[model samples]
Target chain A: MGHHHPGSVSPLRTLTAAVRHHRDRNVGPVKTVKLPRRKLDFFASVLQRFGELHAPVARNGHFVFQRVRRWSEARLEYTRTELPPKKYFLPPRETLFRFTPGKGYVPESEDLDRRIVLLGVHACDIYSLNILDLVFNGKYPDPYYQTRRRNIALIGVDCIPDQRCFCRSMRADTVEQGFDLFFYDIGDYYLTLVGTALGDDMVLAAGELFESVTPDDVAEYKRRSQERHQRFQLDVEIRDLPEIFEMEYGSEIWEELGAKCLSCGSCSMVCPTCYCYDVADETQLGSTAGRRVRTWDSCLFATHAAVAGGENFRHSRASRVKFRFYHKQRGFVAEYGRPSCVGCGRCSAVCPVGIDIIEVINRLRGVEYAETEHAATR
Target chain B: MQATKPTVGIFGLTGCAGDQLVILNCEDELLSLVDVVDIRDFLMAASGGDEFSTLDIAFVEGAVMTRRDEEKLQRIRRRAKALVAIGTCALQGGVPAMADGLDWPSAVRDVYGPEGDGFDALPARALHECVEVDFSLPGCPIEKHEFLGAVADLLNGNPPQLPTYAVCTECKMRECDCLLVDQGRFCHGPLTRAGCRARCPSYAVPCVGCRGPVPDPNLGSAMDVYTSKGWSPEEVVQRLRTFGPLPTPVPAGEAA
Candidate 1:
């Protein structure tokens, strides 16, 4: 269902810049390393010099993104990680301060000063993280998160000629500019496109490391990315997703998911973009030593919103389940013009219950079964 | 610092203790709160003071889970010039109420030792269990910001203006594609209250109905949303049943 054109690399391409500012050193824009794929030395050099580089590192039977000091530790090619690359921003829990008898309060917030380059980020994770950026960087920007974000740079790599991926369905197959720089593994050398000024500065700074993309490099990157797009396993007609839910607002599917839902909040936890949180005040041993802290919150919690008059707004597991999906898929996008779910596939992949997001979205659209058969079941 | 201040007491009951934790989270404005409100008792936080005079303002959390708790709540109500319910546990019975399922006896039996006759509880009255509650601020643990807003409002001689709308409305305003329509996912935003600003949804989490049902929520529409998500009718009713410890068959501000 696609074609290969001679020069239309509009969908995907690799380009350098006049003033690219990629950072290789922890302090400056990235210093490029233009070595062959096997030249692990280049990678080693980057990680070694930085002392801190976080990329997709395998761990716990599932691929988890972690800090990497060497090339061997980095896993460039992967299907999906157990967790999306969200922990990089809003950590699971963070203490805001410590307070006691009110003589003085202590703020224990820390910002990671060491620069981190996130490698092998999937488009979905990119999309999801973008939503997070929009949120944390909203009206009142979160100083804690912003400090780290400004120091870090995102490096996105396309999924290896797909075994299976639903990023396209979730509208995340292609990067619409979130990364400071993008890398498409094109055989010998990475076809890199400097995205932000930081990216351009880095690329320009490393004039010797990265070669300008010739016509051939651009062509190869396109061919490979397109092939993957066509072959990608999940095909969701997402344009009409909102309409599907609108029509099925009375559907029985919600309760079904709810019934099986452990309400464990695992799905939300693994999600790259799920950032709902709760702020708490932790007093030290005395009334004086405590600080306000923030931790991840789940909608599945039954008491999320109940009033004194004894009214429980969303008390059902189904409702919790429903609210999570609607908020991500539709509500969030409508409000922020950003899709909350970056299609990182972490939620379904790590779900103990085996609820696949792709499957759920398809079902929402009434994937199969005629009206009669469906009606009979109902 | 301000010269004089109003006396306020904050308390909690059976939920996850999230509400108390939330208010305690008011970091920047905390010292100010401590200065302004003379907190007499906060079961979750402070060891508590005993003078227990008429409180200018009383902040209560969690549902009435015990006889002692009921008595404590009544005392708070009677003694406080103003009372505010903070959190789902205090406002709506919270999760414990979900287990009630109308058949209070069976619900109790489901818990306790056996024969529905074990450590006698005041026969759990419809999850709210007992006591008269004044103002209500819902949320698993009241949103720290919202809790502050409510407190601040009270200080300004105006109660916090909580959103009485459904979660779905906020979701829509957030421009989140309907989860049910876009991705066959079930969400109770349509029937849940606003105020949390639909945080869960934007975070990519579903509405769990922790906020409790909205005023005159369209149970019928909510059930229909579930159907589209491929849930069975039985599942829909079962879901709705869990949230309304004491079903709000009528609209908010209307009769039971």
Candidate 2:
């Protein structure tokens, strides 16, 4: 029902009435703000006013999320940022501690007090961050990652998939949670859904820049969401993934993947949820003072599974390939009750040799397709 | 008491001495490094002696493109306890290796005319082909940080950490846009080894793979990206062959 007229009631009174109605409903309030397409840049600038704003920008003919100096630099329509937003939380190279050769190691603390606004994040990436939160914040929590996570804010936006994207299959195409704010393009206005209190605070802070969403805006948002779902070209039935991975442990598909895989570690590096790391100590050139650093490590490396005794647990290429898939699909679910892959299509996009996850899943299902041979070679 | 510093030598052969220049470019760290390691021989930085001497570590640059180069590499290998190949030219035969499949004599004649007869040259080959290499630090011009880090590792009795991943790893870390996917450019980042910190991509240039191919580079997938972008198989192969040897040839009868 559209609220076309409020009998000349004050805007604040109308807002209070709406909030009270939502409170009475005994459910979390869903607040939506509308920003005209022309004012999208204004909203971005507003975000920048608060803290460092990172959004997708064109770099060397490709789109990457970089620190923006101006609102015009942000590419809201981008399909995907080359790398996921995980780098902000968990950097590739991070100092864990500083140590003296004879003395014990001293833990290195980072300054995570600065505010950072991650803008234009895709729904898939938001989902990926949620998955990372579970891992980093569970059991023995990572203080460095946790500190950084707390300092940064997330703002998600809707994305149109290229053929490579399979987030829909993984139920990551639209996120119900994990973002402070989620934006959906509806005609000339952006329908901004305030998912958290932080999002509401942001909306309130920039109150003059946004208006309350109309009933027509809501309808348009729903229509566009439906359209986005239908547009996805790739789909994997994730419900069957655990069973499929378990049953296909001895399948020849892994061998095919092994043949195609270079084990160059591109897929995992670009993946938002791949969080394995290797820690090393580096002594200074002349001094005994040194720092201990941890760097991103990939499961695909032959030495990744190698033990101190020189026995490699997952020695064969086929085994490593199988291990990676099983870890993401079956093992992760077994441990965390969910698959690790959010299906952002980064692995497929960056796999120099075309080892697409969708195609692999299809082939695992024995789907007769001409592209299977080509994918196998890739 | 002056503790005996680990003896180290820097040598170059038949390519651009860019890798050595990169080491010298480490202006801040260079002076401090000399205190940790003995600079037995560094012709580029010093001219103490040309004669080969026993050393604890030898950092060799360039590729072996002649009998003299091969002999020099063997001598270094014999004298040094550890030999580190510095730069793509030394590690993978680099630009010099591009002439491998071509007729050497004719190629040389084409470049130098009849006067090329006076020059004696051989097909370019990696240093490891002639002698054992303890480690390899690969790049067009080796990343200064990596060089410094590797030397530090060796001094500490730790094996120098080299990147086992592709250039895509660094590119992703740097958050540089994927040229291959977004712009349909033939970037070899996913197939090339990392350590250059995605330099080319950071500046918006396509990765020409100056760091050489990763140990298990997925050449087929790299080719697929190019082909999907409307590049011919020949064009893909040619682009790939620019930095390192092609993994496989595009079969005959494929559209050029």
Candidate 3:
């Protein structure tokens, strides 16, 4: 029930264990591999030791999670990945069942239900997983997702001091639970760390490959994560959030975004956390055989909020845009007790029209409310 | 199928029938559902009845905005074996929930001049404003698969579970490049629950969080993420309430 992780683990020790864990299963409790200034070969070692290895790799001028067979394939120092590591658990399109109408739901299929070990997950993404676990594991429990989740070996990496990160502000800088193992890419050594029983087991098997990390290293990792928060040089104060919302209930900013937004949903599609989806049942013409599938959806599209009677509740792009903004910040806070945004900045990075959430927050905070209010008075 | 057959009744009050439509969209499976249970009363479907039979489940859609609707929902609650609040209207009041902080009379006046005397007025709130509900399925229209899952589980002698994870979970699962990383589009996926599998993201759009918030979503972090991008607190708040709700804090250590 509890994540129960001891403090943070050293990145160097974590890598050492990863390589040792797979190379020789019988190796003395290989749970981590502290890469102490090892070149790309260390990464290759992990790949060779384990059947496969996953890490962030630069592709088409963007970073993405890919299979790293050799160390050269790994891009340890990068800006950001196109998609977060969460795909390893609950994929975009997964089959919940195969069915026939008269017989009812068949409830079994595997597309994204394969065993995968995810690596290089950032803290913001790690927190995103916790959210996913809550959803898929809650109430009835999604067996498909659970099976994949149970099979995964999460390996997290610290946000490099670059990449314009704001994890500190969003608290994505650190996660108390979710990852099985974590890695902090220190200059000389990649601190291979442990976060769970399985992770501990992997580390125990690594033998001398992993040693007890020094306290200075842990403090340095925390320091780097914290210091990097300032490097982004962009932020919303969060103090005036409620008050800003009060007046922003009817702002012109929403219409502005709507006018330019094509409603393509590319932003949501690429984000590390947007999860709206639609479900439909399909079958061949003459047969009763059919299966219900859930596909992703976006509130930005007019049809997203449309109902049976042809009435669109959040009809206007402004309203729809505003609704999304509120849900992550104010709406979710009131309903579930926390703001839903992880501050990954994926939305800001992927918009075709360049609608920045940070800018919206600033406008709402009266970055110019006073000037606008005065002009209206005049 | 009548051996201890589950008698189910469905009712809608005010707000968009999006939730009802989601159920209706269950088309192919609808017939199967009918075969498994005796649908006692469903106002939107051809299967409603006035026999006033005992009910095992009452799927309530829309917010209880009117007095008559309130009474009807209360009666249904009394008669049904279980009560589920479907859609944001029933759960958090949907778009109508937008009226929560405002005065109804003024709102009516704003939309209609003093001559708009045809409008009826009453105290309003989410479904909780009128009756007790056992479960709530958020989103303007509750996700159909989730609805199906809950219904199927209920029929199988189990309760349905709703996802409390933020929308970010599904967004990442889509393997979509984080839109905010390369562009400046703001999204609400991190704060919104993961019940809906981030359909908007797949279509290359940012999430507007129609399904609402996950339990214990981190507003501080969301704001920090934005602010780090030079967004002010007001801007973050604006984004949080894009759906008409001011992001609130989660209960202590509660799992989303």
Top candidate by DockQ: 2
Query: How many residue pairs clash per model?
Result: 101, 3, 127
Worst 10 residues of 3 chain A by lDDT: A1-10
Question: Model 2's chain B TM-score?
Answer: 0.93
How much lDDT does each candidate structure score? 0.63, 0.78, 0.63
Task: Give the residue spans of candidate 1 off by over 4 A.
Answer: A1-35, A47-51, A100-106, A161-164, A204-207, A307-311, A369-378, B1-256
* Model 3 spans with C-alpha error above 4 angstroms: A1-33, A39-52, A111-113, A161-164, A215-226, A240-243, A368-378, B1-256
Angstrom error at residue A39, model 2: 5.0
Worst 10 residues of 3 chain B by lDDT: B247-256
Put down candidate 3 lDDT per residue, B1-256, tens digits, no spaces.
Answer: 3756678887888867777878889898888777767777887876537547778888888776777888888888789778888877677666665555567787788878895455665534567767777777777778887887777667655556555555654655556545554454677776676767778866778887677766544454455556657677666765565444554533212313
Q: Each candidate's root-mean-square deviation in Å?
A: 12.6, 10.2, 16.0
User: Sorted on TM-score, highest at the top, how do the candidates line up?
Assistant: 2, 1, 3
Model 1, B1-256: lDDT tens digits are: 4235677788765556788888878788888778666677776676756446778788887667677777777888788888888877677676666656456666667776476575445433322446555678888867876776677667756656565556654553343444544455666666677777678877767777778876545454445446656788766666665544634233212322
Q: Model 2 segments beyond 4 Å from truth? A: A1-49, A102-108, A159-165, A186-191, A207-220, A367-378, B1-3, B50-53, B65-75, B99-125, B177-187, B204-208, B218-256
Predicted structure with the largest TM-score when compared to the true one? 2
Question: Model 2 residue A272 lDDT?
Answer: 93
